[model samples]
Target: MTTPARQPAEQQPAGPPRPAGRLVLAGAPLGRATDASTGLAQALATAPVIAAEDTRRLHRLAADLGVDVPGRVLSFFEGNEQARVPQLISALQDGQDVLVVTDAGMPSVSDPGYRLVAAAIEAGLVVTALPGPSAVTTAIAVSGLPVDRFCFEGFLPRKPGSRRRLLAELAGERRTMVFFESPHRIAESLADLAQALGPDRPAALCRELTKTYEQVVRGSLAELRDWAAGEVRGEITLVVAGQPAGSAQVEAAELAELVSVREQAGQGRKEAIAEVAATAGVAKRLVFDAVVAAKRGG
Candidate 1:
């Protein structure tokens, strides 16, 4: 997705935005409360209105951090997120800073807060974040899989048919994937992923990350599925390796020919190589190497 070129400041309408209260998105730790950032602590201690996914968790976290939440605590979870966004926005519009926190990790990431954030933005309010530990990045770093280029799919579909359809669509994805899964559904999801992505596809199961019982299990999709069968538990983050490079599906000769054809049509080698890679859904390096090998062979 190419971002459109920004208009010149002079040419911009600017929406004539107003300055009221800002929305602070605070990221909570996946496990240990200590992982919370200082900014997060300060935000929790001082925000005038807090929209928490779970008020109980917020209180527990504050207790652990030895801070007091002087602000009015409001429940802002999935079930009530829609109903509560308006109220939170109202508070912000009244020049009262509103802090949004989820039970774990960043808000709006498979959690509550997106609606409120979007509302705040549409209302021309300032929005900022207190970043902290995220299971998606942590699991990818330790997954032993390629992480330079990856995508987070969040939680996999719960329904078998939906899950299967999604898996089928992702079968050829070349970017590493990260997903959140429940302990009960881990076994079934893994099995389905393996069946769709292939049994030998590399993957990792990260359970209770950063906690005392933290475990990182790296193996093939089939192996992870088997391990998940034997009493798996905890907040899970699964990292699966992407399908092998698309070059594997195309002969070097064919890849070289594709690039050459594009080059013949008034395209520079770099542009031709990029075009071939994009069309073939492969990496540029692979296509370049194939072109080089074909030159040597000739």
Candidate 2:
């Protein structure tokens, strides 16, 4: 009989090995403090270094979780993240388990942990995460739109022209889109979105997710734009459905009809172009070009 083949030690199944000074990115609660995971609490308690977007909020979370954060909590925010990453990397190199926590949601998802995480990974240090709740995912869940695939656009440009231009560029996006907008700008943004995307486009406006006063308004972009115009308040997350099939077939004739409809409804020429473009699932530039062409009798 042939002798049984001997397996190498590297091929043998073994118990989990200790991490080489792993970097743990912990997700903090979006609202209530009770949402933190047990693993996150323990990591916070035992980590040798803590990097937080907001130190005060980190302290608050530690207090709420009843976890004694023995490690020094250092500020790691947008302005300082780049400069602070090297220091965090050094700590990790020194065999210190560094835990990164953000003000809310997961660190690095529209939060401040990306730089340090990227740096640690580049340094060949083991990096892991203690997953927690995220407003982006939560809002998408309640949005009632297609969630199979989606793109998270943290926020639209503040300027109307820039925002419209950006929306125009997204006209051909095939996946559902998510956006974070301040309450003050939500109305204008929705209005611009409806004009750029089309009034009939399906969408949802999610507000104050996971909070006591959470609200989700689902409807066509036009209707939501109108709704937003009327005393809307709270943190906002907007979900817009993607372009529909054969949407590109909407020609100048159909665009003219759209312009006529909205023009009669008190929409300006520019706004009409935006609305038509959005409804037709085409670019605002296309619709605007058509409108200009129609005016020039092209």
Candidate 3:
């Protein structure tokens, strides 16, 4: 007797689409206008209502797509997202599809659309997304560090102590990490990353991705910190190699080597420590310990 063949998983039906009068969180181009998806353009051109982080940018994007935005557009941003959600939800309840777009990237990832998305879900409104490029992922891809698993810490606190405290919390993270920082503070933040994580840890400074003058500089965190110190400009994304397992025990020896090499290369103690920790993919504390031990002949 012949046995019946099992059905392939690909044959499984994906359930029906959610109702139409829902909220669509769309992604805008981080840079390179062509990165916008077809679905995003369609939604922007025809959604019954468009909730944009920047209405002027929305209009500019519509012009780029050569499509007039006929929908009613409302400004929704960090300051106004919570307050504006109720009004937007009321539109969804009335069977209008609302599209939420940020100036760049997906609306809710380090952006202002999370509140509205949460509100819509609670209101039993269908929610969807229009996928697009993300700086977090893009920077990680080009960072030359392990990306099998990673975490995005977004922007760290502005204050030095607070920022250092946050980095301390992440000292044990084994997965690669991504962060965003302002151009003005990139130097200080990188120095902090070097100090907290380690000077020799591998990292990349991604600037103006996908735009003209797009640059990805891969070096030890300390080197990038020094480079940033001179004169840095543009939106910045930092991708750091994660802490290596068992790095603590061998840190002293590694850091000794770092100090020796950098000293020979003409870098001073502070600069050597920062570069060594960042390049070694270890913590700055480890480098500091090694430096102290070297001084004491331990």
Candidate 4:
């Protein structure tokens, strides 16, 4: 038989090599595995490499969802996330799809995927996300607070002083605020929030979200602080109502009224005047003058 002419390498129709690898940040269930989306399950099942914030928790999640993660699992947490960036990037460069997941919620929102994602972007790799349950959004949705415009504050500083300073800075933030807190410190945090943001500020404490013991408590910051004082458990998310528009334009009369209210609530005259001045974004002298004028008028 006549030998067929071999196709030149240049003329070979091998098709385009599959486009370079992808990095997918998948959101895990906040509490219930049943809340996981189909895309998340498929990613867990098929990705060649899986980087998890908690490997053991990832496995437990897989078991809960009855999905098998057949890929090589790597621990990608806060401690080692930076070290693992190069390895994960190498995998993506080698055209292997990799999935990055946290123990709960989407990766990189107060999670470990930020370093990897930023590294991938700098390295010119394809990076995408598989949206799933988020405690931030879930808490806001159930918070009954104004969500038309909001900001996620994530976790506040753990130390009381730092936390208070941060809260004071945000006291005048007009956008609705969302925060995450550990169960142990929720009460103290709430109390500090009440003190810094004002006791009558509308807020909600969403605890153990999307779980059997889920609770959403909505009230003034003071009430929530008192409620949080007794045996609060599970993951907690706090949503605080934003300062009203033009709240900074408080009239002297309004400031005086606030001082009176605080005084009625057992705050000393000086303490109440100072509190009103701070909250109303006015000067202490102005508040003191207002209180004095009101006292003379009464």
**Model 3: residues >4 Å from true position, as ranges?**
1-20, 249-298
* lDDT tens readout by residue for model 3, 20-94: 488988989988778889988888778989999999998998889888898999999999988998999989988
What total of clashing residue pairs does each candidate reach?
0, 6, 21, 0
> Is candidate 1 or 2 superior in lDDT?
1
Per-model TM-score versus the true fold: 0.78, 0.76, 0.77, 0.79
Question: Mind giving the per-residue lDDT tens digits that candidate 4 earns over 163-256?
Answer: 8768866766789999999999988998888887779999999988999999999999999989887897888888999978666335557878
Query: lDDT tens digits, residues 196-288, model 2?
Result: 777899999998887789889999999998888778777788999988757744555577778878988998989888777765656777777
RMSD of 4: 8.1
TM-score of 1: 0.78
TM-score sort, best first: 4, 1, 3, 2
By lDDT rank, best first, the candidates go: 1, 4, 3, 2
What is the Å distance of residue 228 in model 2 from its true position?
1.9
Highest TM-score scorer: 4
